[model samples]
Target: MTGKLDAAFGFHETALRLRSERQGVLASNIANADTPNYKARDFDFARALQQATGSADPAAAAATPAPALARTAPAHIATGAAGTLVAGNAPLLYRTGTQGGVDGNSVDMEVERNAFTDNAVRYEASVTLINTQIKNMLTAIQG
Candidate 1:
């Protein structure tokens, strides 16, 4: 029962964390939109989520060759190439701009904003699902 509960919530928990991390990455791009030579970086959310949930594609992971960081202590800061990856410490990829900036800044406000907003919605959904799962587990235990 304990194992099943853990397995059930694992994907949602990882998704929540990854989505939160992606939000920050997108926000950073938006924040640095004006900074010269600020190359925008982001990861494929679907790929990241798949990796975090231990559903990574071996071919993809092998091609990328991610460097992972393990947090053994509670006080250890999260690895921020996007918060120390879970299934693998996949590196962030640079975003290609539709309209290049004169100053070599890669961030496009519209794209960044859209991605940020979309990630927020997905994050909230993951949180809601997790909460529902917890509630169901509690009810089952109580019964």
Candidate 2:
């Protein structure tokens, strides 16, 4: 039962976490907008979410000779491939500057603000879905 719940909620939980992480990066970019030589950092949410959900690398999986063994730990999800990128550790890509700045700060206020707002909406959606799932589970167990 616990494992089932974990599997069901895993994607949402990971999404919430990754969204928060991305928000932090965006916020950092906003906060340092005036700082000289500050480079804006961000990641691809789609790739991060796919990785978090233990999405198989189709190419790698197809070429594999044998299936991966199940992991023993509850938190040890995924044997996707030799180099599966984790959500928590997704590589950060520097945001390209739209206009030349004398201070060399790549933190664009408009871009960071837009990204932050988008992330916040997605984060809220993920939280709402998680809550709904929990409520449904509780109703099932109680009745």
Candidate 3:
């Protein structure tokens, strides 16, 4: 039915939006690698998708609190501080490197490269899934 197609389209739309936003965040972190005091940021894709899709709890929307603002400076950087301060359901935050750099920048080249690659693969998968869904719908209508 057309309604099924519509539902599939909605899911694809949401997936695309999420993927685009994630790509933007990753690209921003890569771009700011050289900037002093710039902290890397990322989001938890699974948790965010669950929240967005209303899968975890229908009432979560009403109970969820606003994302905390990123602190420009603090008296001291403590362990686990970043865990609590994500900007949104994103679950993304600035990561502190195990090995500190002279400039206080913590962007690890290898880690970022891996993350970028993984994200790209996931994005491609999402696109492929959407395409298949569309193809299925078209076949159904044609038949």
RMSD of each: 5.3, 8.2, 7.4
The per-prediction tally of clashing pairs is: 0, 0, 1
Q: List the residue pairs that clash in candidate 3.
A: 42-92
Can you tell me which runs of candidate 3 are displaced by over 4 Å?
1-3, 57-64, 67-88
Best model number under TM-score: 1
The per-model lDDT (C-alpha) reads 0.80, 0.77, 0.71
On lDDT, the stronger of 1 and 2 is 1
- For residues 24-65, what per-residue lDDT tens digits would candidate 2 score against the true structure? 889989999999999888887886676567684758535633
Candidate 3 per-residue lDDT over residues 1-117, each given as its tens digit: 679767758766766777778788788788888888777777777766776665756576557554544555796455352334232254566766757667877877677777888
Residue 122 error for model 1, in Å? 0.5
- lDDT for 51 in candidate 1 is 74
What TM-scores do the predictions have? 0.78, 0.76, 0.73
